[model samples]
Target: MLPHERSLVKRLQSQPFALIGINSDGDADKVKKILKDQDITWRQSIEGSTRGPWPTKWNVKSWPTIYVLDAQGVIRYKNVREKAMDEAIDTLLAEMKGAKK
Candidate 1:
């Protein structure tokens, strides 16, 4: 997942795309290590625990919960990955281009 995420971030460098990581790790030290070891370049919010504010509010039932939001900050897709994720992003980018014109 990290590799794919890195690819997405690199590929969308010139676009209005953001990959915000909401980490639910209990230990802040471990999270920092992960960020460095994994080479995570995107922005991250460090929630204290799985029961932390972000996860609690979003009702995250799984570990790697994925959400794809549009330019207007609306959640358009959830729990999608790989090809489906790419398709959703591509469609949204195209829509963004059409909207600009």
Candidate 2:
């Protein structure tokens, strides 16, 4: 999934797309190392603890939950699978482009 997402990020580099990651890993140093090793260029925020306020605030029930937002910051899709993510991104990008024209 990381490989696919990394590729998507690269492909969408020219577009008005951004990937934000919220990591629940407890160890900050380990998370930093993993991010660097994994070549994750996107901005990420690390939760102090998995059972902390961040999870409760976001209502994250699963490990890899995803929320896709549009240009206006409204969540267009939630908890979509990887394949669906690609389609959603494409659709949103098209909408964005259309709005600009």
Candidate 3:
């Protein structure tokens, strides 16, 4: 997922897009090391404790959940499959571009 996500980030580097990760990893250090190793440059909010407030607030019930939000912060896609994320992003990016004009 990280590799695919990295590719999306690279492909959309010129557009108004962001991939925000909400990590529920118990160990901050381990998460940090993993992020560094993966070359993940996006902003991530790490939950140091298991099933922390973030997950509860967001109502995340799955291990790996994907939420694609628009520039206005409205959720445009929820639980989007990894394979289809790029297409969703493309749609949103196009919408954003149209909005700007």
The global C-alpha lDDT for each of the candidates, from Candidate 1 onward, is: 0.90, 0.86, 0.83
lDDT of 2 by residue, 1-101 (tens): 78978988899999899988888876679789889999988777778667657787987888887889999999999877678999999999999989999
Q: Rank order by lDDT, top first? A: 1, 2, 3
lDDT of 1 by residue, 1-101 (tens): 88999999999999989899999875778888888999999988889788888999989989899999999999999989988888899999999999999
Q: What is the lDDT of residue 44 in candidate 3?
A: 82
Candidate 3, 67: how far from true, in Å?
1.0
lDDT of 1 at 26: 55
Clashes of each: 0, 0, 0
Worst 10 residues of 3 by lDDT: 43-52
| Higher-scoring candidate on TM-score, 1 or 2 | 1
TM-score of each: 0.92, 0.90, 0.88
What tens digits encode model 3's per-residue C-alpha lDDT throughout 1-101? 88888888888898888888888876678888888998998888888654888888878888788888988998889777667888888888889889989
Which residue pairs show collisions in model 1? none
